[model samples]
Target: MRIVSFGFQTWGRKTLQALIDSEHEVVLAVTHPASAQSYKAIWADSVEELAKEHGIPVHLTERADAATIDLVKQAEPDVIVVNSWYTWMPPELYQLPPFGTLNLHDSLLPKFTGFSPVLWALISGAPEFGLTVHRMDEQLDTGDILVQRSLPIGPTATGTELVEAGMALIPGALHEALSVLEAGTANWRPQDKTARTYFHKRSDRDSRIDLSWSAVDLERFVRALSEPYPRAFSYYRGERIEILAAEVSTVRYGGTTGRVVVQEGGGAVVCGPDPIRGDNHGLVITRVRAADGTEHSGAEFFTRGGYLTDVPE
Candidate 1:
């Protein structure tokens, strides 16, 4: 099948490679241009570099402009495969392919349907998360599912770890969807409207930690935002401190929320709630990056009485 793929970042590279490895012909590969912003997220293999190595044509653009649409139309693609893309694709672009568009989403549809689906799924304390290859519609991720599979999220798994696990399944997932299409046995199901949850793209504020959160939730939040996504952060002394890793405190500390309860080799123990069930729990911040751009053990950064609050302390 002739395919035109639109993607970016690591997921893009994986999905494109899956297509190349398969029997299908990928005529055009489209990706986002390099960013000039400081604090870029973690990345894997470059989609552009991989496409060039495979001799696939590359198109770099923010939006699917007239020329891009024209280019895809010229490719005469059988299907459009889109994964890990940021642009809002118009129907004209996805509808160009005869087989319709297949979108590779990080989570199963009707749940975690929007930006950072994996992260949102993890933070929501879901026992499992999955990937889905769905037929794209006019709505965002509201497409009918063609194929889906779920994987367990281990207790200690970080966001990067989960991402890698999902990436490992891409080749098989894409193959499954493609095979279904080839055999004409595609089973499409509409996502349950009641079970749907849409997560918006994160911002600096989204990464900001609220000490009011329970230790378990705080830990989940930190891991969810860890490397490749932005690290969950808080302000201290008018400087931003990114929390790379943290743990639920062994001992409960009662004081002002976000107050530094202790500074030990284990990390900075911050006061939250007494872990009695639903109250805020304590956190042991294991690792952090200071405002001066220096990474440090939480013990090295937080002094006794130095609170890690939203407001500078």
Candidate 2:
């Protein structure tokens, strides 16, 4: 297939690379400029660089502008493949392709429809996340599904772990979708709108740990915001402390919510609820970074305080 591509992250780089590795012809690659939102390119490979390596024309823009639309028309690609795109795909550009626009979303269509799909999936304690390739229609991830495959998330999977696992799955997922795209006999299915879950863009503030939540729930929350993303955190004596690792204890630990119930070596047991078992429980924090940017044992660091709470003095 003659292809035009769009993407702005590592996922996009991988997707475009998949096309290069395939028998299809990639005529153009559109990536993003290093704007404020994408300054974190430390984790992202250069799609533009990769495209040049493959002798493909590259364009860096927010979206398909009038000039870009003209270029897409000139290319007359068989299909337009997109992944991790921050901007909308204009109908003028997507419709220019013979096979239409195929978007690769990280989560199952209708579920986690918008930004941070994987983070929300983990936070919700979902068993699995399905990678989906769908026909784009301007709506955010509400397009007809072209190809999808479910990937299981372990009970204690961290955000970084989940991301790496998804990255490893993408090459195969893209290949599978490409096979369907090439045949031009894709089995497209409309998404069930009632089952959809969408998440908004998140910030470091969103990583704030809520001590009042159940141990199991907090553990999931912490894991969802763990390394590669901002670590889940809480305030101590008006100072921020990031929690890198913690364990859930189903057995009750006596103390108020957020209180340091027990401290031993690197682990500090904090009070929590056993919402599932209908009993009190605790979260044992094993690793932490204090407000001063110093790493410390959770037990040793929290030993000076009896409780960790948002309550005013």
Candidate 3:
């Protein structure tokens, strides 16, 4: 099969490699124009580099411009495969290939159908998440599913961990779906409209912590936004403090919510709800990053006796 691949980040690399390994002729590779500031750079290796190595044409553009479309059309590709590119693709672009375009999404369709699906899955406390490869339609991620695979999200797994796990399955799923497409026996399942849900892009403000939330909720918040994100955070003395690691505790202190309850072992306990069977919980701080850009243990953050507080309007 003559394939045209549109992708960015590690997922794109993996999918392209899979197509190559599957004995398909990848004639053109398209990716986003590289930028230095955003973390997109981390996962981006020069697609041109890989294309050059494979003697394939490469297109790096901000959009599916006339030149890019011309390049793809010239490649005479039979199929178009989209992996992790962030831009909105127009219908005409997807319709160019004879076999049509297919997209591999990191989350199961009809549940999480937008950007940052893996991150939203972790924040939603879902124990399981999956990948889906579906035919591209005029709508985003609303295509019929050709292949799907689910994986468990361990209790301690971070957002990055879950994304990595989900990304790992894209290659195999893409290979299998392509085989079905080539054999002219592709079986697709329609997505349930009633089960569909979408999440907007998360902003820095979304990472802020609310002391009024239960401890378990706060703990989950901390885990979901850790590392790659700015970290779940709260205000203290008019300065932002990032919570890097935390635990939920049953012990309660008479102190007010967001007040420091204890400081020990380089970590500190913050006042939160006590645990209940069907109802309450408490949040504890195990690690943090001070506003001055200093990373500290929970105990270190507490030595000054500064307490977590609601952000002032």
Candidate 4:
């Protein structure tokens, strides 16, 4: 099969590599320009460079403009494969190929759609997360599913680990989908729109720890925002502090939600919800990064005892 690849960053690069290694030929590659966003920089692999190295024509565009459509028409690909390609693609573009466009999303369809799905799945205490290859349509991630690969969310899984796992699923999923498409035996399943849960793009503000949440929830939040993806953070005594590692406390404690009430195990216990009733388990922050960019054990940093507030005091 002749293929056109639309991708960005490491995800796009990986997809292009898989196509290059496959039986099909990649005729054209479309990708976005470099981004300065911290999230985009994390998995920074150059799809454009990879395509150019292989001598495949590359088009850099933020969206599917008139020139891009003309290029795809000239390539005359049998199918289009996409991953991490920002911006909307119109029907005239996606529906151009005989088999239509196959999009790779980082979460199971009918749930966790839209941006940063793996992180959102971890933070929401989901049992599992996976990759999905579906036919692109009018709505975002609402297309019929062609192939899916899922991984269990372990008790201590981090955002980085799950993302890598999902990326690894791309080769197998893409190959399988292509085979089925070639054989004309693809079993495309329609998504149950009722079960769909879409998430918005995350900003730095989304990482702020909400003290009202249970310690269990907060622990998951910390793990979800683990290394290479912006650590969960809060303010302490007019200074910002990033929580790098944390867990639910062994002992229960009650005070104001953000108060650094006591030292427990190897960290400091921050009181959680229901302080008046004094019945909530505290979040034990084990590791942290201070405002000055110095790392410290949570116990060592909260020695003076103060409140971790949402904003500078």
Best by lDDT: 4
The 10-residue segment of model 1 with minimum total lDDT is 271-280
What's the TM for model 3?
0.90
| Candidate 1, superposed: residue stretches over 4 Å from native | 37-41, 263-280
Task: Indicate the TM-score of model 4.
Answer: 0.98
Residue pairs clashing, model 2: 110-196
Among all windows of 10 consecutive residues in model 3, the one with the lowest summed lDDT is 272-281
What range of 10 consecutive residues in model 4 has the weakest lDDT sum?
265-274
The parts of candidate 3 lying over 4 Å away from their true place are 37-39, 253-255, 263-280, 310-313
Q: Can you give the TM-score per candidate against the true fold? A: 0.90, 0.92, 0.90, 0.98
Top of the candidates by TM-score: 4
Candidate 2 C-alpha error for residue 77, in Å: 0.8
What lDDT would candidate 2 get against the real structure? 0.79
lDDT over C-alpha atoms for residue 246 of model 2: 84
lDDT of all predictions: 0.83, 0.79, 0.79, 0.92
Please give the distance, in angstroms, between residue 298's alpha carbon in candidate 4 and its true position after superposition: 0.8
Which is better, 2 or 3, measured by TM-score? 2
- How far is 92's C-alpha from truth in model 3 (Å)? 1.3
